[model samples]
Target: MAPIKNGRLLFNEVPTGYPIPGRTTVYDGSGTIDVESEPLNGSILVKTLVLSVDPYLRGKMRAPEAKSYNPPFALGEPLYSHGVGKVVRSEHANFKPGDYVYGSLLYAEYFVPKDVSYLQVLVRPEPSLPWSVYIGAAGMPGQTAYYGWKAYSKAKAGETVFVSTAAGPVGSMVVQLAKQDGCKVIASAGSDEKVKFAKEIGADVAFNYKTTNTEEVLAKEGPIDIYWDNVGGSTLDAVLGNVAPFARIIICGYISQYNGEEPYGIKNMRQVLTNRVAINGVLVFDHHARYEEEFYKVVPKKLATGEFKYSEDITRGLDKGGEAILEVQKGTNTAKKVIVVAND
Candidate 1:
């Protein structure tokens, strides 16, 4: 095994506002990964590679009193997120020294997780696909779209499904999944390039919401049966206004309001009652039990058969992790923005 060291992204103090500048402290491998070298009888030591920088992570950076779910990133401590890595050492009976794994970890090169019950060990490494896909298509975003489609929206063939943030990891998958179900998919992206990518991924209609008014475009597009909302705010309000009766609005995320000081309000929620629409907020972790069964069972099969497609925008280093995360929120990334911790 390679020599273990301490490497991490650290913050001095939590930010109180937006456009956070160079507050991150980057530590190259230099210290012990854990206080104890031996796993607590059932733990594994993973060497992290790719780390995910998601929009929701911004919420975690705020003061704990500000929100729920995940707590604030501790001042002067290593930040953490979902990452793909290899098991360099293991004491757990289920894992071996050379096995590959993917799970939550501190933003460090090596992670000694005492409780790896939640971590998944990769059985087959596919050379055809990049390891980063485990963070996208075969990872959280994929599961988000998959379970969101099957459980909440229950998208049907010949229906018109509208998706916001259509070029993102989850949004792109929703677009392709809806298309494969024989639904006419309309997607809204933040830029022309993202719109083009959405169309390339099989969205029947793709529009840049930054240029065209969402309400105006949806008005011309007519009523939609399903609304897969990733960017809430005005886009969701517009979608609510144009939704068909018995439509399903999947509340995947609210990226637009993530950075705002004041909460953005939606003015058209009455449509939920008037149109008998069903709106559901989804968290991918809620469906962890069926993750492998669903991804490997359905999504991969479709991808292999050319029925689904996905794209990623990878940042080369952990030093750029914060920048990559900010870029996604700013809609600067055309696809899933991931930070590659190690190439090999």
Candidate 2:
């Protein structure tokens, strides 16, 4: 077997604030893998197809000594995240050649995972959507939205719901789900295009948070009964001021604070007390057992039939890996940001 070229995005340095592209994470394209001969040893050899670049990966880019929910990225190894791939070879009985799988895969052209527990065989729908959806709308982000809404939002008909970063994977799903539940959904996005997309997907009202005043929007459309928060900063503080009594707040991500040196301090603590708001943070990994099967059954079918709409911002090739993560971190991405490493 001849050595085929392999490129990987390596965690080069720990960033003090926003990560610098070749300095913080370096793309090394000089490596090679002999696909036919690479040792599997109860592992699966995956020829990476597409990688999911997410905001959460930014939090894991810290120094190894730092303690967090997920471990820090190794200084010189390939960065890993949710991805869809084709199995080239397998030593494990559960997976075999040509199986398309999705899970925590490396940001490289090829990978042989030391652990296979995180990987699962992808369930392709009857009328197929793009494989990227598995990592975007129908994967981790989708499940996060589904489980959080089911477990925490406690939304009822005609209740006003506000979702921050509402054009994003998780936020967009929350908007659509809330609408389907007969809730009046107000969505906020970083750009006008995203705001438009949010409205297109069933938001009763959608606004550009960057240009529109968050406090004013919430004041008009809320007494918010449910708030699905993605960007946790001033927007969250403004939400505190406008929440209905007994409002349920789901803290999905603090994307605004991930790249910052310090966390944003919310000044409206009294609002929480006065409103009797119940705040809970959702980490999707924690609730997968409760929601994974149901999500796969429902969301994928809706997506295929156009009962639900999803937007993905895909950057072609592994070479764009560094820029893809940067797009997600900076909120430059209009929707779910996915890097397509190869065609299936």
Model 1 per-residue lDDT tens digits across residues 1-344:
34455566775556655536366334444565452464445577777788877777777777657767767887777777777888877778888887888778778777678578667787533446677877887678888889888888777789999999899989999998898789998899989999999999998889998788888878888598999988788788898889899999999888877775567788998999999999999888887675658576677656655567778898886667667867877889878888888766
Q: List runs of model 1 lying over 4 Å from the truth.
A: 1-5, 19-21, 24-42, 125-127
Lowest lDDT sum, 10 consecutive residues, model 2, at: 122-131
Give per-residue CA lDDT, model 2, range 1-344, as digits (tens). 79999999999999888888898899999999999898888898999998888889998899878789989999999999999999999999999899998889999999999889989998676348988998888888988999999999998999999999999999999999999999999999989999999999999999988788989989888889999999888889999988899999999999888986477789987988898999999999899889888888899999889988999999998777888888888889878999999998
Candidate 2, number of clashes: 0
**Most accurate candidate by lDDT:** 2
List the lowest-lDDT window of 10 residues for candidate 1: 24-33
> What is candidate 1's TM-score against the reference?
0.91
